[model samples]
Target: MKNQNFVRNLVGTAILAALVLALQLLLGSLKLGPFNITLTLVPIILGAVLYGPLSAAFLGGLFGFLVCISVISGNDAGGFMLFSQKPVITLALCMIKSTAAGYLSGLVARSLSKKNATLSLFLAAGIAPVVNTGIFILGLLLFFQDTLVLWANGQDKVIDFLLFSILGINFTTEFLVNLVLVPVLARILRNLRFVKQELAV
Candidate 1:
């Protein structure tokens, strides 16, 4: 029974990973002024809520890999480069952001599940964009702060830009997209028999 359960969980994780990849590809095809909205993290959140942090991390890493490939190959119109001129750093940021988002989602879900499963799932889905945007902004500040400051022509302006860009524009856009999409997707997935049997443990 233990082995069977493990196999089932493994299969479920694989499906979730594939779904993440598919969503990334689908979102890549759309354009939104240098920012394409994606529900890729939804699967990661669901996997984390269902399986555990390790599985979620693995799926997140897989999603990051897809993003890296798309960026490097110019498959998504090279928006992944983000004026960095450095593919390695860009790739590293993607991996760290996705992994952290997934791990946090799983941890939050696990902690809150006993009290309120529905609320926990909701938080799990909602936290990814916040985490993702926050980290990306931090990374930008750390790596490109000098360039941004120069561009802004003042330190104060640079700070303001970072604050607004990170917390206002980027976070708001990602939050709105996730807010609209994740609940519906979570509901649909929750109703699936396989999801219930495997994830509701």
Candidate 2:
């Protein structure tokens, strides 16, 4: 039984990882400004709700790695600009934000599940993109402020430019995806017999 659970988890993790990779590669070029639309957050949230924090972190790390690749390859113009200016910090920011997103989503969901499972799932899903984008914004402010100013093109408020021009669409899409999709899909998976048994354990 233990081995069976292990196999099931391994396979599930692999599937989610593959989904993340495919989404990142396929929609990776679709950027509103400097950031990708981030269709992968759904799977990351799913992994968090189902497999656990570690799996979610793994998925998020994979996403970070892919983003790094895109930046290095000059596919993500904003990210590439940051990378060109501050290579190590850009890399660290990329990795840390998404990783923290995934890990926190899972940890929060698991922690809150005892009181209300559904609410916990929704919160978990909601928090993933929040953490992801929030940290990215902070990273920009802390580490990439000058670049932001350049991108702002002498705008009166760089924060306005960042919030409205750069991140508005990207953050909305990611947030809505996690909000609508994660709950429905997680409920479906939780209804499955094997998953029910695993959760019970």
Candidate 3:
């Protein structure tokens, strides 16, 4: 039973990872200002709620790596050159942001499961995007503020362009996407037999 459960979780994680990758690719093509609002974190959130932190983090890291590679290869829709400017730094930030979001989602869900399953899932899904985008914004402010200010074209009044970018665009985009999709996805996943059987306990 133990081995079987492990295998099941592994397979589920792989499938979720692929789904995240596909979503990222598709969403990357669509631009809504600075936020290319994507459902990429949905799978990671689901994985975290169903499996555990490590699995969730692994899937998040995997997706982040793929995104970094895509950026490096100039496949991103924005063509912002996020990876080209500072490859290692960009990759590290992506990995850290994604993994932390995933891990936290799982931890929060697990802690809240006994009280309210729906609320737990809701929190898990909702928190991931905030964390992911928040970290990205912070990293930009810390490392790439100068470039961001130049790109702002004087429209933003904030001294730190990164801060303005987050408040102005990134947070809104992330909030809108996650708000619309997370609840729906969480409800659907809760109904799945595997999820109910393995995760609801």
Candidate 4:
């Protein structure tokens, strides 16, 4: 039984990881408005809820790697710009933000599941984008402030430009998407639970 569970987990993790890779590589440039919307976060959140922190982290790391590929390939103009300025810092930021987002979301979900399962799932979904974007903004301020200032185009308030002008739309879209997905994710969880129970029997 333990071995079967392990195999199931391994397969599930692989499937999620593949989804992450495909979304990052193929649909990474998917955009609704001005900024690019990252669809990869959804699967990472799903992995967090379905598997655990480690699996989520691995998927997130894979997402980060694909982003790095985009940067290196010059497909991500902003990322490439940052990479040109600071290669190591840019790559590290890419990896850290996504991985931390996944790990933290999974950890939060696991910890809070003991209380209210639904609330924990919603919060976990919500926190993924928050942590991902928060770390990105911090990394910009810390390492790429100059680039941000340049992008601000002589604006007096860099922070305002960064948050409101740059990240506002993108963040809102990601957050809303995650929240709206709660129902679908909840249904998936229930179905999975049913399958597991049946298998156990």
Candidate 5:
């Protein structure tokens, strides 16, 4: 039984990795209103709730790797030219923020699942963007504070730069997209769970 579960998880993780990569490559950024919505976070959140933290971490790592690819390929949003100047810090910030987001999403879902499974899933889904963006902002401040100042040249303070210039439309759209889509996707998956049980027979 343990081995079977392990195999199931291994297969599931592989599928998810493929799915995330496909989405990242195919539909990574979709422009909606004034925002560019990133679809990669969806798979990370789904893996967290369905599998667990380690699986989520793996997905997050994949997501971050894709981000690096975007940087190198000249498809990144804010530009990663700085990455060429400071490779270690840039890579670490990217990977750490994404990995933490995934890990925390799983942790939050598992902790709340006992009390209320649906709520747990909903909350877990909702927090994905929050965790992703929050960590990103914190990472910028910690690792790129000096460089960020140049970006925020006209702003009175870093907070002003972050909130008004950095996070305004894009992050808001990303958050809303996750809030609405995650729950719906999770619910659909939950409804389809019976099919897996049937397959077990």
Candidate 6:
């Protein structure tokens, strides 16, 4: 079982990491306005629910890596511009928030599922976007408050700036998307005997 666990973790992580990259690169841009509407969060959240926190972290890191590549390769002009201005800090923000969100989602879901799995799934799904956005907003505050304000052009107040410019529809859509997809996908995944075995292992 220990060996099974180790193999399962490795294999599962690889598969999910691939999924994250594929969805982002193959499916074309999911961006709207100043935001990149994310499609990869589903896989990260799924890994968290099915595999474990470590697997989730691995998937999240892969997601970040792909994003980094996308930016560096000049596939995303806005991302590349941001990376040009604040390379290290921007990369850190991307990786840290996503990685933490993935790990936290798995930890929360796994813990809560021991008591109430239905509630656990929703809670876990719901938490990731909040954490993701929260960390992003915090990162802006910590690393780019002046940049943000300058971009906002001093028209909007801080809270209003965050809501309108930052979170806005992208945040709502991401949250709702996760809320709907995570549970539905989890239900499908639950029927898979292999997924169950991996989880149990």
Worst 10-residue lDDT window for candidate 1 reads 28-37
lDDT (tens digit, per residue) of candidate 3 on 87-192? 7888798789988999998899889877887778778877888888888878866876665665666536545454555555665666676656666665666676
What are the models' TM-scores? 0.81, 0.90, 0.83, 0.89, 0.85, 0.89
lDDT of 2 by residue, 28-114 (tens): 445576667778888888888777899899999999999889889998888889999899999899899899999999898788777
**What local distance difference test score does each model get?**
0.72, 0.82, 0.72, 0.79, 0.73, 0.79
| Residue-wise C-alpha lDDT for candidate 4, range 1-201, written one tens digit per residue | 989877877888897888788878787556533336788998888778767799889988999898888888888878889999999999999999999999998898778776766777788899999999899889988898788888777658786777775577778788888878754855765577621321111
> How well does candidate 3 match the true structure in TM-score terms?
0.83
Q: What is the C-alpha RMSD of each candidate to the true structure, in Å?
A: 3.1, 2.6, 3.0, 3.3, 3.8, 2.7
**Which residue pairs clash within candidate 1?**
none
Kindly list the per-residue Cα lDDT of model 1 for residues 112-171, writing each as its tens digit.
877887777778877877787778778777776665575456887977765665456656
Local error of candidate 2 at residue 108 (angstroms) = 0.9
Candidate 2 wrongly placed segments (more than 4 Å):
191-194, 197-201
Error of 5 at 60 (Å): 0.5
lDDT of 1: 0.72
Largest TM-score belongs to which candidate?
Answer: 2
Better of 2 and 3 by lDDT: 2
Cα deviation of 72, candidate 6, in Å: 2.3
Q: Give me the runs in candidate 4 sitting further than 4 Å from their true place.
A: 32-35, 192-201
Tell how far residue 116 is off in model 6, in angstroms. Answer: 0.8
- Candidate 4: residue pairs that collide: none
lDDT, candidate 4, equals 0.79
Error of 3 at 65 (Å): 0.7
